[model samples]
Target: MGKTPAELSIPAASISTEIPDIPVSIPSQLLERRPDIAVAERQVAAANAQIGIAKAAYFPTVNLSATNGFQTGTLSNLFTTAARYWALGPAAFALPLFDAGARGAQMAASIDAFDASVAAYRQTVLTGFQEVEDQLAALRILEQETEIQNKAVALAQEALKLTSNQFQAGTIGYLEVMTAQVVALDNQKAAIALLGQRLDASVLLIKALGGGWQASEIPNRDKIGGKTKWSQFLPIPIR
Candidate 1:
């Protein structure tokens, strides 16, 4: 049997349903590649190194010394007994007995610096998450808005055409036609502006994520625990 027109013709409504899904995961992927996070991590590591240096001050300084030499003097002692001298002993040991709390203060300062680095790391991580979330939400909302605006533009254009035809036929006044044209133009301009906004938003998101955007490419979201591990070493949140 041959197909009827109803079966052969594609439905206009189905066109919308056929639209491909947007690549919304780009931002997420960018976030995973963010270099700022790495920089922050390095800062934390540097802070830790400083703390180690400070802590080392609490240990006593140990030194070993050794001296060996052949003594040559006047003819009387030149080769008389083959003069030789050798000495080996612990050179010196100095422990900070009392520095008016200087050593302790230095150690405390190192600790404080480390704590600050930890807090900074946490802030960076939190800011990253927030940026990703905000961009994702904006993208989602804009997608819907764009779809609706597109439909509105189409309807406005159609209305303008109908109104123009009516005015030419003397069924409507010129004012009505002008109003319709203005409405259609406004709708079209709004849609264009919205498209530009979407593009800008995408760019901002890409920047925030740290480039090479791809949301689905992001590592397992579960891996990002709410608490940053660096914070564990700090006694207080760094200002």
Candidate 2:
């Protein structure tokens, strides 16, 4: 069947297949593939970068200024060398030897923020794995349940036919025919409900798998350790 645009967005690797005994994924492996976890990882990176920004305050600040203009009030003497004047070389430096431990406090706070992001990322992975497992179990149980319902419906249908034939031949009462009819309808209704449940489970299972996404696609710390440009981050949105 054709896929919707939203469905197409999931990575093909994350989709369900007909193969049996699909292996469960490692926790770290699932963390890499989930976009929510990738976003958390980026938050960690951003928090680490803030640490550098805080440390930068400890460096010296450079003050630079320059001025050049005609000194004479009269417009006539504005172009003359005698009236021309300029001032420069008043640059100064202010080193931040200390800030009453403010820098240290900022660094510590950044470290804590990074740690929190890492913890969030782990929780996201755990939650994602749990959802996948839950759906898998649901699908399995419902599959068997649907099969049983199918058998019940078929039996009910056959019994109803037999009852109808017997009633027409005056071997059974009208009440027996009505009872068989009700049983057949109830079993068929149950089968329909089971089919709907399986569809719901399939969709949930796909979502848990990150729509065919893989963790390897998320960038690691090593990729951002060097001189990186703003444009380099364009290809992948945090989510």
Candidate with the greatest lDDT versus the true structure = 2
Clash pairs for candidate 2: 10-211, 11-211, 11-212, 14-212, 32-215, 33-214, 33-215
lDDT of each: 0.76, 0.76
- Residue 101's C-alpha lDDT in candidate 2? 90
lDDT of 2 by residue, 4-58 (tens): 8557764424224432333356233544555686677778788888888887887
Model 1 segments more than 4 A misplaced: 1-32, 64-90, 214-239
TM-score of each: 0.67, 0.65
Q: Lowest-lDDT window of 10 residues in candidate 1?
A: 12-21
User: What's the TM for model 1?
Assistant: 0.67
For candidate 1, write residues 1-239 as lDDT tens digits: 49985579654342222222346334434565577876787788889999898988989998889997767866667555577787898589888787899888999999999999999988998999888778778777877998999999999999999998998899989899889979997998887777777777777676677763545555553443234568666878664
